[model samples]
Target: MSPATALRRNSDLGAALAEARAAYAAARPRSAAQHERAREVLPGGNTRSVLIYGPFPTAMTRGQDCRLWDLDGHAYLDLCGEYTAGLFGHSEPRIHRVLHATLEEGINLAAVGQGEERLARLLCGRFPSLAQVRFTNSGTEANLMALAAARAFTGRGTTMVMRGGYHGGVLTFPASGTNAATLPLPFVHAAYNDSDEAARLARAHAGDLAAVVVEPMLGSGGCIPAQPGFLAALRALADETGAVLIFDEVMTSRMSGGGMQARLGITPDMTTLGKYVGGGMSFGAFGGRADIMAQFDTTLPHAGTFNNNVLTMAAGGVAMGEIFTPEAAEALFQRGEALRARLNEIGRQAGVPLGFTGLGSMMTAHFRQPLPDRPYAASPAEEALRELFFFDMLAAGIYLARRGMVALSLPVGEPEMDRFVAAVGEFAESRAALLRAGGIAG
Candidate 1:
């Protein structure tokens, strides 16, 4: 396209985005006021970085059965699924019963509780790699403990992590550089899904490498599933280099009963889990081969006030043993697979430059064609176009992450899925020219 034509197209895209932002702001007066009040203490009126977006975010009041109501009283079909922690949805009857029963029994018993062992056994039985397990308050804490254990066990300080992989808050490694909040570990970065580079790095740091941590599917980095052979290559490299291979399945654990490792038949030395496992409560777990986890039993120290809290343990037991059984997990996986296929088909039929990438029950929409295999492989998403899409989806009564992430909850049935699919089709058709002109098709 000529410079003048390109400029005009770009100008049009900007105008559309501005109009959407204005509409979003106008529609959420109460949420905006709430944010202003929060700003009195919270930075940018936000405690979580991901929750922040331009024109402010809609402050949600409550959710139930895959539906969320913002402070402004707009109800939405919740596709965000609390970033995958709402697997059982906002209200699962069984989970609620368990939580209530546990609360009645007591909380923070200050001693090893009865509920912990049962939940631990269930986890160890499900995941092939987890011979033993320990709990934490969040996935971030679980990863910290896993890395600490690996470093202590291997007697090495250097850790290898994939670029664009987010294990937790402090363990994030973006494409360009480490996030400001990242832990000061001796982290060496490697590209996601690049087994050869991973191999080279492992060999290079073989002597000092304690662990090579990765997400089987990049979660916060765009839900890009690791290519076949990539994870297997890491396994081989870790064995060769004497480095502990830790799979951060915090979000991807919902993929199956045993997670991606079991599905792919490639197990890691350690696995970190959180999200949905606690039946919607704050939770995380780390476990692996008995020998590695044994250190925690004696030499290494693992302590947390709420590690064995009755509420999480009891609720988690019900979540794993009753609600999200292996059969249920398989069914959800199939449902997610079908949903992703349908969404991609819609985009293709509309001739729009939109795509979705992910594994079971979790996906991210991309406004680019020829979807990326890794985060850095493609240019950054067109923010204007992405924001426009977000606003449009919200207007259509579908709630998803600003970054286009969608994590399906158990309560999200055919009706919710149909509405979401219809909304996407509408967006694709209405904004085809703008989407095409945003240089996403290339």
Candidate 2:
């Protein structure tokens, strides 16, 4: 398979580590005590496992510019970038002002407001594919609506979930559902871009698959962008099989002006968006064809109490207006290229397999050889190296996703990128010295 094809694939990252010692050491005494106290009330001392990293997670105080300061007062250049949602960075002055103004107008009245309609209009205008939109409070809710619409429109229960594809942590697209289910459910587990395989799976459940939901770019599963033919093939298959093609752009929307689907020139029947939509406020949305989206009006169960909360709409509107510029998106892509180039050059000098590649604004560094487009199902050693590199990166002051994806925001520019590149250089140098003492893997 081509590198792009393999990049559409997913690898097994192995385990959730507990950097208890490191996490403990990193926390201030009061913060550490708070963590200990919370364990009694909050399970695992937190609500979400995704938020808690190995050892324990840091207690964040606040963010400004492109940096985060923990409760212990240790400041780290924010590279996680709020999982790629804080496109304009934390507490941006202009966005804050807009939101503050919205608050003065009253929060909500249990009915649609001009703010909601205006935000939706801007979203639809910027994304040509989103002709009509419904605002939801979370990406999962947006995806749920998309899936329900597909099922309602197509009258099929089964949805084709790409193997290892994550869609808002939904069971309809669960990690194990693709291969293990037995009935009219998420019955297909076709690997990305394998037209023949997906073709076979669709035929096996002939006429039963309502939709084929895919992430144009995998966010949680190692930041792997789909190969070119992959999404095109899915689009074709959905048409042939009469299945709804839904692109879950929740996490991948930051990739371009219209998101990864636009970057790749692939359009689906329905597209769900979130993350950046909130613009650092809580928000989510899904939009598509006028006919298909008519399902939203079908009086089905798609309502949420805080669906289009006024605050999210106000801030997201301002954020969308500012961020949808050609200059801003282009500048972000350029920064991605510069960061990757510098990192790879240092990788060469340091003798590590460290390299970065991505489409539009998304990018990630790998500790192994230049990866193929498919999930190599990385061997045990390769997986170990990935984990070791994560901890090493932490030791070097760059906190990246344990999975290795290094998403960037508009605020992250030359200085931030340079600091990040330098960290990679130091990692590479130390890693190479270690390898020289032993040996290096391709």
lDDT of 2 at 242: 91
Q: Candidate 2 regions off by >4 Å?
A: 1-31, 171-185, 376-384, 433-442
Q: Candidate 1's residue-wise lDDT over 304-330, tens digit each?
A: 998888889999999999999989998
| Top candidate when judged by TM-score against the true structure | 1
If scored against the real structure, what TM-score would every candidate get? Answer: 0.96, 0.87
Q: Can you give the lDDT of residue 48 in candidate 1?
A: 94
List candidate 1 segments past 4 Å from native: 1-11, 377-381
Report, for every candidate in turn, its global Cα lDDT versus the true structure. 0.90, 0.71
Q: List the residue pairs that clash in candidate 1.
A: none
Candidate 2, pairs of clashing residues: 3-373, 5-373, 6-373, 6-374, 7-373, 18-55, 19-54, 19-55, 20-55
lDDT top scorer = 1
- Report the Cα lDDT for residue 208, model 1: 100
Per-residue error (Å), model 1, residue 206: 0.4
